[model samples]
Target: MTGLVIVGHGTRSAAGVEQFAALVERVRRRGDLGDVEGGFIELSRPPLTDAVGALVARGHRALVALPLVLTGAGHGKGDIPAAMAREQQRHPGLSYRYGRPLGPHPLLHDALEQRIDAALTGASTAGADAGTGLSGADAGTKLSGADRAGTWVALIGRGSTDPDANAEVAKVARLLWEGRGYAGVEPGFISLAQPSVPAVLERLRRLGARRIVVAPYFLFAGVLPDRIVAQSAEFAAAHPDLDVRVAEVIGDCDALADLVRERYAEALGGDIRMNCDTCAYRVLMPGFADKVGRPQRPHDHPDDPVDHHHHHGHDHHHDHDHGSVAVVGGGPGPDDLITVRGRALLDAADVVVVDRLAPQGLLAGLRPDVLVVDAAKVPRGPSMAQETINAALVSHAKAGRRVVRLKGGDPYVFGRGHEEVQACTAAGVPVTVVPGVSSALAAPALAGVPVTHRGVAHDVTVVSGHLPPGHPDSLVDWAALARARGTVVLLMAVDTIAKIASVLIEHGRAPQTPVLAVQDAGLPEQRSVSARLDEIGASAAREGIRPPAVFVVGPVVALPTTGPTV
Candidate 1:
């Protein structure tokens, strides 16, 4: 049988859960759904993972996970899908399709309109706004100037870090105002990003709005909704005869229940809807032009050509889990060079699968609860197997653990990060990538050797030296690199530095070209040794240079850090 999983952004308020559950029950009463269950993204019982387990226990091999959100914000686009995908990974034979959020859907508009009408009716019946024609039950009843003259609405959204989601709130506010008889609809946020309630209220007043209805765009009553109501009360108290009223949340209405069924059906029928025409990946737009035509593969159909690397029996622990992988680049072996966001994610990670190349100091400083898996890959040496590492990631995430793939340097730059991403995605796992400072550029700069200089070098080509220049597996075009009158940066070339230098010299590079090698770049034990191209290999051997070193080969290496810091 097919299952319907409703995922809500959980709240601490018990009333919020009761309202959400009532809606879930309303949907379940529909004869079309089988084994319907609801869960929260955070802070509540029957989390997304448990919701899946409930359906699985009821003999549901196929399920549809629907998001109960108003917009495609972080929760809708990332967290909910990630949690669902990770849960899917746990139940191998089980297949599921994810549905988008309830919002921006026409039915949502209808429900919100209903809430507005109910608020207006209550005020009208109570004779609060006596002269205001907004008192009538008939929505189409023409409003007098006294009614529309200073009437406006302030929509309260749980403002998000995602700009697009916040913009949607503003857009919906405008859509709700069109021919709806209210003076205007002002958009405001309950918290986080953007126009606060007080600010939006003040703005509305400036725009000639006298009477206002503060409507929270939340699906259920929660602490946020309570705060919205409290804020409205405070504002009303501050302004005498303001005629400000707080509307109930978008509660258990027929429209909302119907929309949940619609989303579920859409997921089953593959009729998922979101604003995709303007997606940055599809069309080149300002500030996002570079992402043009990139393959945006979120949903993996059974028909997709894939290579699955993971296999497991009914190793049953229907535990609370959401499988996700964060591939983070730890940067040139230093904890300090890690980005602020990277550090935050690291601190929040439950399991950190680290590479041998990542900063060892950071590992020592990690929270004691963090389970560290050493995926330490050594150049031509013993290390964690790539397949096993991929499996470990899947395993931990399926067990409802957050896994961070911590590597040295930028994950995509010869770090085989793309492979990890492919692995996780193929296994129906969600992956997040965080780029770090590559040794290719950092090694050169920290050693006072600029890879690119205006008058000295026009380009900088980063190449891997894991294989010698003549080795068939080596992808570096030594001949082209040698002929180019620019800096050539080499990483993982310590063992083959001599042969690589010889190949470049043979391929037309000047034997007198200066070469500078920086070992353990960015580390306290950093060492920079310089020699001519012809003598670098011998000099490195004499200095007993090791792997995890970067070499800069070009005329720019001849320049010193003589220029002061900009």
Candidate 2:
């Protein structure tokens, strides 16, 4: 006789553990196998050892260890297998085979799509129907065409230390949005990664999402997904007009149950097919090639392992005080576009002072207790006061908190990051600056208009158009810039583009020079406006382009498929 053991990355939450246990029970009730049991790799109750001993006692010689995780990450490929190896040494007579992680599979994708549909429909007709969950034709019927056009779906993954695992969730999000007609699907993380749910939700609001749904990629209800739910509520409360809803976790659904059984069958027959394509060791992933083929080494001290079976298990490695401020550039608009160093700092920070233009999707996935300071006040007139933002950075640093001042684009590229850096220095606070992909170049490139192209332009100049052409406070040499032979990328020039274009034309710059304006830069809602230098302002006005946009002037603006022509 053979027995099946379902191995889960156990959690501290009793409810979470119960959910996994219930899933195991559901699989057993189906009654297709002889003997079945559930166990944990770590943290929560009955360990895998207990499950193995019990099964062997129940007169079983062969067993299968099925890892119930979304990716073949450390837990799936290393930890679980290592633990199983230990058990194998203990029971020489018993034989067991390991199965693959449960993800990148079509069934998993189907479950996520179903979760999205249920969330959208449930919110649309919540109070009207009691106990109705996407029945019959309602499952296929979209909530509303208007809502569908404006809604954004945010998929929250239990972020992993392995970058490949973290990236898989993003791929899943993109695939879900490819053919579906929702406004967009954004990738978010719940733990150990960027683009937190709240950040993504706020970003969706800024990108004009009429309603947003946050769907967790967890196979069971756990602490991380619970935090995602709370973050959604917090964001909804903050922005009363924005409708935020959380979809169900991939619970003990039939699809997941079927997936578990399939893995069991595979493990029993010695047919484990691991995902090698995304494996860092086999594939040359940018920064992880050195990790290739390294044998799994155990680091858990048995006492201070990752899981503690208690609520206080997740302490974010802040035993020492980092009484300094890290000025992190968030890159253009996309969450994943930010550099790896910048993201790592965000995950470890105790206080994150963020700008409106920062990669907001990263915020939604932060630890539930991390203090997030909204620093988007307008510098001069409306919005958050820059003085206040500077004061917050200085104060937070002085208070001995690990502070991360997150800004959009390069900190020095018209982001006012230098001013904040200077303020911290003046306040006797240590500061470190992490460079990021500036919107100036990122926006243009994302729009298919590189600032400089081979044989098209040799040099590129980036200038802030916030002060207009002839403002006394402006330091830019308009006439000199007009004479340049390369591309000119302008930021903060939306309102004053007409004057700037006029000044360039007056300064002997070509009136017919190609111009491209990219709004909402690297996001899915990004729109491009293209026109000759003389008519760009009119074209921008006609197309309703907004600020935080970049305008590219020169032949490179014509590099992309002409955008929306004037």
Question: How many clashes show up per model?
Answer: 5, 15
Please, what are the lDDT tens digits per residue for candidate 2 over residues 11-75?
Answer: 76677777788888889999996688887765666677777778988988788888889987777
lDDT tens readout by residue for model 1, 294-361: 33222221222224343222232323234468888888877888765567667657789999888778
**Which regions of candidate 1 fall more than 4 Å away from where they truly are?**
123-149, 277-566
What TM-score fits each model? 0.53, 0.51
RMSD of each: 13.0, 16.9
- Look at candidate 1 and give me any clashing residue pairs: 86-323, 150-210, 321-400, 322-400, 356-376
What is residue 93's positional error in candidate 2, in angstroms? 2.9
